[model samples]
Every structure is written in structure tokens, then in C-alpha cells.
Target: MSSNLAGNQATERKRRIEKYFQPTPKDSLKQIAVALLAGGGIAVLLGLILLSSQSFLAVLLFIGGGYALVQGAIRKARYKAEYEKAEPKPSDREMDRTLALDLQQIEDRAMHRLGITADHLETGAASWDPVAALLADKMVERPKKRPLVLYGPKLSDFGIGEDGVWRFKLYEVLVICPTVHHLAIYHCSLDFLSGGLSMEDTEEYQYNHVVAVSTRTTPAPADLSLERLNTRDPEDDEVRFAKVLRRRLEVSVSNGQSIGVTVGITDEQDSSKQAVLQSSGIDEVIGSVRRVLRDHSRP
Candidate 1:
């Protein structure tokens, strides 16, 4: 009577648990059978060893274990096959469409898909000397070793909005050995910069690129020099400096947002130094800033 009552309670408890955590019939059966067979075999082996089991008993135990193993294998194979069958395959048309687009177009489409706004994009260029690439690879390979500093008042001037919120980063470009026909590129971002930006479901980080080019150039002056210019807003010393450079060299600023530069060796001695900025897409990104920079720079 006590055993019967205990069994009834266990059954009731199992039913209640199953109501909240329902599993498929096949899976539940397989799990229960595997657990029971495994536990029972282990218990029987221990018991038989203690009892000094007859040869016939040992043979029966071995046969049962083999059967259990085969059963488990069959169930696992079926489960894997069912899972693969359930997954959807992409259509050929979809794959073809993706393969058809050029890199720039692909970038644009990805941006559109992610719902990134024009305001969300930030553009900047870094010189890509082979020496620099090697140095950069060192940094990239061991990011934690070289902790980036987020310090300094310079970052503060990046701006705070009228609503008392700060604008974060949305996009970034690292141009390596930029030239008229080709460039080497590295794209990156920090979470702080991208946190507020809206992006597409499938899109994660802003697109980054590395490119190489073979032709054309933008001229840079013989001496790399810096000069400060006064501005209405002291906070924009960096922007003002950029503006001064644009005025002197004819680089452009776009949408009050982007900076478009045309950089190269000024003369014959600087051939290997090469052009560092001459990207059409860079102009597209900077918008009318291109005209401002180009017009000013034109001889």
C-alpha cells in the first residue's frame, strides 16, 4: 500500500513538471530510456561484481549494454537528420543578387538594410605606410596588450547635443596608402560610438574595409607642418585646424560632418611617400565638401 501511494505521488509530480517543460515525445522517450538503461547497467555491473556473477550472467549484461549503445546511436543520428531537414536553404536568386553588387554598392545596401542615417556616419583617414600596417597588426593581434586611452579633453570637444546627450560614434574608416585608383583600408569602431546608432537586424558593426590601388595620386606638401587658426568656438580647435588645412591644401569638409582630403607627395623626391587620399567614394560620403575642397585646391 505504501509503495503504491509513493508511485502515485511520483507520477503526479512528473505530470505537473511536464506541463511547464513539455518536450517532444521522441526526445523525451529517448532521454528517459537512455538514462534508465545507463543507470541500470551501472548498478547491475556493480552488483554482479560483488556477487561474482556466472559467465551466462556476464554475457547477458554485455549483450544488453551493446543493444543500448546501438539504440542511442540510432536515435542521435535521426535527431541530427531531422534538424538538418528543418533548416531552410537560401534561394539561388538571392545568392546571385548578392554576388552581383560591387563593393561600394554592397556597402550602401548594407547601410540601408541596417537603417543607418547619414548623420550616423563618421569618416576619417589614417596614413597606411607598410611600417604602419605592421605596427597596426601588432595592435590588432593583441588588442588587450595595448589599451586605447579614452582620456583627454580632445574627446570632450567631439560634442554634446542640445538635449544634454552626447553624440557617439556610428561609423569609422581607416584609410591605408590611399591613392586615386586604389587604397588599403581598415575599418573599426568602439561600443561607445555605436551604442546610439540604429542598424539593421543582420548588420552588426559598421562596414570596415582594406583596399589596395595601383594608380593616381594626391599631392602633399614637402614639409609636414602644423599651424593653429582662431575660430569662433574654441572647442573646435581640431576642426578649425582641419579647416585651415583644407583652406591651404583644398581638402573638403562635408555636411559639417565629414572631412575629405586629397593627399600625396608634393614633388619628385616623395614618390615612395606616395598619395594617401584620392577616393571618389570618400567624396560621395563627404557630399558637397568635395566641391569645396577640390575648388580651393585647383590651381
Candidate 2:
């Protein structure tokens, strides 16, 4: 009984969300506009014919008809612009596939660099943390020794509102493996938006050198820099009213530099897309980083 109630409540919430984006019915608006235009045309013609004798009535007709015509034209124009979406293109599906392939390549590269065998990895013996379980579920190779990873979208910002509320994401994967003396972090970026893989970057941070780890959402900078990172998360009106929003997660490291992962909920995205954009995955990855710092960072 409780489960059923929860399901219904969820359904209602989604319905409300979808409703917020919807405008007046396109067909209804178009029909009313056409009617007004036709009526206004007839009224103007009658007024012109009666101007010689019925001047007062003709003047009234002219005023009313002109008002109706203007109103109708305005409404009609709005409908045309708001309803006429451009034809769907192959680029959407192609982009999705391209991103997937790029991410897969980076994951493979990380596994190879970390010395995880290609034969297979058993999740049964992997870390029980949610992030580890998720990595294990990939059936991909991950170092069994204090393995951790921080991965998310890189900065993606486009000038066009055609992306709607959500901009596309280019992913960066950071695979961290701890050694007796230091932590070897293997990282790479996959940018399918334009094309091709970014060069792999591997750096070793001594236990004591490693300092802070965090995840935060901030306004995407025009230049994608680390400066001026202070900003509040978008709320009800802020999200709903904005035409486009480019968001990224800033991950701070011991080094002066920080990395960004693209992830967030945007106004125009539906519930399913919103779920996919949830920051939970990013948070879990951060959680893994913290665990590593707690257990292995220079004491």
C-alpha cells in the first residue's frame, strides 16, 4: 500500500514538472488567430465601403478591426516560432555514439596503464563501497590495491541556446592507484564533441603532498578557468527561467590546479534526463577519493 502511494506521488510530481514547460496548445492558438484575422479583414472591408455615410460606425469598425488584426498577427507569429522545431538530425545519435566510444577508449587506456589484466576482474573481492561496486560492475580491470577513481565531465559550454538547458559533456577519467611510496593518478579526457582523444596525463603525488579533495557545481566560466568559483546552485526560478545553463563540477587537488566534471540538472531536461544528470555518481566518486585520503594520505 505504501509503495503504491509512493508510485502515485512520483507520477504526480513528474506530471507537474512536464506541465511547467508546456505552453498554450499550438493548434488552439493557431485556430483562434486565424479566426480573428478573417473577421478583422471583413470588418475593415465593410468599414471602407460604409465610410461615405455611416462614418461613426465605420470608425468604430476600423478601430476594433485594426486591434483584432494586430493581436491575431502577434499571436500567430508566436505560435509559429514556438511550435516550429527544426527537423531532427543524425548528429544527435552520432554524438551519443561518439561520446560512448571515446569514454570506452579512455577506460581501456586506464586499465592498461594500471597493469590490470585484460583476462577478467572479479568484483566479488573488490571494495564494498558503492563506487567500487560500480567500477567492479563494469567487469573492467581496476587495481586491487587501494584503488580509487575520480571521473566526471570536463567543461562544456556552447554559445547557442539550441543545446536547450543542458550542454553536452566531454568526460575526464582519473584512476588513482596507491603504491608503497606514492599515489599514481592516471587521467585522460575524452572529447567526442569535436573528435578524438586527449593526451593521457599521469602524475605521482607523494602521500604528504596530496592535500584536499572536493566536488562542487559552479557557473561555467567563459574560458573554463579555476578562478571565481564561488556561486550558488540554481534554484526554482533560476533554473526554470534560464534559456541555457552550462554547469561543471570543480574538483580541487593538492596541486594548485583543479579539474572540472560536467554534471547537473537543468531546467528544460525531463525527469529521465535529470536522473541521468544527477550528481550522485560524482559524489560517490568523490567519496572514493576521500576514503583513499583517509586511509593512505601522509599521516
Q: What TM-score fits each model?
A: 0.19, 0.43
Compared with the true structure, what per-residue lDDT tens digits does model 1 show for residues 1-299? 99898678656533432221111234564575577567556745754674554766666666666666666666666655644432232222322222222223334444455444434433223211212222232212111111111100111112222222222112222222122222212222212211212222231221122111122343224242212322212343222222112111122122222222222222233223221221223322233223323433455
Task: Record all residue pairs in model 2 with backbone atoms less than 3 Å apart, i.e. clashing.
Answer: 153-261, 153-262
Native-vs-model 2 lDDT?
A: 0.50
Per-residue lDDT for 1-299 in model 2, tens only? 99898678656533432222233344788899998898888889889999999999999999989988998899899777655422122233333344444445565667677665433332223332324333333333334443445445454421111223232335566655555555566777754333345767766666567666654544443444321111112222323322223345444556676554455533333222231331225554455556666666545
Instruction: Evaluate residue 28 in candidate 2 and report its C-alpha lDDT on the 0 to 100 scale.
Output: 82
Where in model 1 is the C-alpha error above 4 Å?
A: 1-26, 29-33, 36-52, 87-299
| 299: Cα error in model 2, Å | 6.4
Sliding window of 10 residues with minimal summed lDDT for model 1: 145-154
Task: State the weakest 10-residue window (summed lDDT) of model 2.
Answer: 226-235
